[model samples]
Target: MRETRTMRPRAAPNRLIAAAGLLTATMTTVATAQLLPGVPASPREKGPDELARMSLLPERVGIPVGGSAWVLVRLAIEPKWHVYWRNPGDSGVPVELKWTLPAGISAGEIRWPRPEVFRTPYEITYGYADEVGLLVELKASEEIGTGARSASIRGDWMICKEMCLIGGADRTFEIEVSGAVEADATDSDRVPITDSEAFAAIARWQAQVPVAPPEKMKLRQMVEFPNGFRADANENAGVLRLSGPAGRFSEVRFLPDATPGTTYPEGGPVEGRVASGRFEVEVPISVRPGDALGEALRAAGIVCLGNARTDPAFEIEVPIGPPTAGGSTAP
Candidate 1:
């Protein structure tokens, strides 16, 4: 089976610009829905006349073998509203990404730009309050020997604001494998993205919540949850249970290992590095109810295909998480 994960390689900051341009290509709402056949209509999300509708784009993009590819998502947002980053800080949704690939092709994890801090008298949050694009790296399958051919990628994601709404759909874009290219990414094809624009935008957002220089003890680490988490699992549903040395580090937040806030911010912002170590918390499971237990263990929060796959290497990603494997079958 193809690698079902955010497999795109990480790029240097300058390449970050190119990836942002290419991936941002699909950020805003595209009038034409990149929907799969038979998928029901997603209620139209409102946007200002000046704001062209955009869709939620995935940073985990793909390319054809022997050719270059960029993956993205488009978020069609309403006027004066925005979505959350991985570190949503107290409240806000995270953009979860999943990719479908053919043999020999590969994709990268989402490369998030810096996010702004939304502070009200009452609470502090992290995210993009307006439309923006996510960027990723996709390389073609060298195995597809030089020739005229095509490769396809499917992306699924969610877009939300103050009120939460989950939109699940698959959109596939094709790439040509011929020595001569037949199509070039442009505003007409989807949307045009520029490196400068992305940098400026991110820089501006960063200004809103710039962290001070790191302490001498700066560090970074991830504490993964056990496999059996759930909405109402053994301990407070799917919330991660923390203990031991981190017991007193009670203040908890979920942010990406790199970019602090865009992808999974559930607490406050911590620079890409931390110090004086000990951390712990109970994290939530984004997996829906009635999902197969094994598959649930797989996709719950991070949408990696590994989240769906177990040791047997059996294939079982059924759009939404699958039902229990080899258990009493549901009629």
Candidate 2:
């Protein structure tokens, strides 16, 4: 886990700042004109109308009755601008969605894609540039009758390049429900996406989503001290060491989940060393004094290896116990 501290907005470039100012001024003028006694206000626009293109897409085959499907909130960002992850790291805001579903329909949590680390002189943030697809699972109640169902989502997000701007869209999706209820849909059950294009797109993003760390990759052994934790005798703050098959990884880093009272260092690299198919590095995990430390501190985070596109990222949830007298190794 990284250290947690509040970050103030950094000043953007003069040209971009000026551009943003002008845009705001223009919008203000338009609003003022609409308020005038006899002036007619322009009709409101629907969908994304900003630096990013947004859409809500369903599988081409549409929704199935009494079964669940994936609905993607897709964002194709304009060049040079980016949007944030569920936890925006040190700065920026995460995407927000408000769903309007039919009485018998429900939506699941937003499945986030792995985020890239972006850095500026002022602050470091975690987000996606270019394009990203956030997936949500939609399930219809068993009693729901077959017919057409409408679902809508109102989304708000902040996009940033040299400066930041808020953007939003109102999008609705229509799906035709058919087929009888399945006897059981276990957690392991999955509906094979049939739309070639849509399936390909989803598969690309889904690969970026981290899964549980394989047993061989977990921090199964650790050395702790009175001051902090480390893989060796070195007294480094929030550091963990691991020796593994280095050949499998070109690089290794950790992207921690948002944990209160903890913060990570700015930028992408999680400091460590790899050599001759063996690796060892100290991972910094900071804990604030006086903050309630439970019986065991569980540090859950994503362990990413190799580059973003090629290799897969793994999730690890490890419990760090308090150091005993003379220090000891964590499980």
Candidate 3:
């Protein structure tokens, strides 16, 4: 309850490093939008249904190893207007967030919710449609209480439609040491084992994230898969089945799917084109436990792409498990 707080980490590392690593593939989208004359712009091609705004929420409040205070970054949108996740799908660019803070304060990484597919005959995209808040977790420096700590944020985002529209703002936000509130610390039983109070308070953020791709995968070889990839939707499981080699996993996770409840920033349906030996599948699964996703599907369900093996070229081929009575993985 009374942890020590320290200075915040510089956002440059995340901007130059983490952010760069996540958005490399997006370069193609920028290059595709050749600023030429008479491109036959379709309805402002980049015109948006609504404007997007960003703010912070106390709901994700937390105190880390240090006495630092943390909060959530909330991105609100007008109806039907969506934004891209860190890893944007095939045809769109990602929304980039840059935070500016004082010496003692620091910010956490942006958690990406799984994405809905945005399909076009040519390209598919991954992003959110309508109202959703992207949780920007933060930490206040321990020194803030002793002295003073503050921070500012500069975010850049490109909201897209049929064509891409780039929009960014250098907005000023603050986080200084404040007096303790009246909330009571959780008792022994109710308290979480490992910062559950912090996690539970923030876990609500999970609500807005996209459904994660399957963690368990058995698919064709890398050399044989197609660039466009293959997809099969299993509404019964509320999951999209992607067919691709281990390396192709990254693309699938970023691209959009056609699930009903899901939404994508780029307009249109996903393009399906897989190489002869390689195929990629995208399935939608409820990240939370005990959902309505069919039982049979759940038994053999592959839920998320773990950090260790989430790369586009990543691969995992389990030796065909010992043959079962039916010679198949139970479904």
TM-score of each: 0.39, 0.69, 0.45
Candidate 1 residue spans exceeding 4 A from truth: 1-68, 120-123, 147-158, 178-267, 270-331
In every candidate, how many clashes are there?
Answer: 45, 11, 49
**Mind giving the per-residue lDDT tens digits that candidate 2 earns over 1-331?**
0111012111122333233233321111011011233534456522224467776654222444556777778888887889998778777999887888888788898888878888888877888899988888878765666666666777778888876767777776565454442344342123434344555676677777776656875444343444644333322355444445556776876666665434445565474566776556455666443342333344555666676543766565555555656554455
Indicate which candidate wins on TM-score.
Answer: 2
Q: Give model 2's TM-score versus the native structure.
A: 0.69
> Pick by lDDT: which candidate is best?
2
What is the alpha-carbon lDDT for the whole of candidate 2? 0.60
Ranking by TM-score: 2, 3, 1
RMSD for each model, in Å, please?
14.3, 14.7, 15.8
Q: Which 10 consecutive positions of candidate 3 have the poorest summed lDDT?
A: 24-33
- After best superposition, candidate 2 residue 145: deviation in angstroms? 3.1
Model 1, 227-328: lDDT tens per residue? 542334433122222222222233333333222111223444322211344543333333334443443232112111111111011111112222234321
The list of candidate 2 runs beyond 4 A from truth reads 1-48, 59-61, 181-194, 215-247, 266-268, 278-281, 289-297, 319-331
lDDT-better candidate, 1 vs 2: 2
Q: Could you give candidate 3's per-residue lDDT for residues 135-213 as a string of tens digits?
A: 6556554344522233455555666555455555444533324333223433321111223333454466555454333
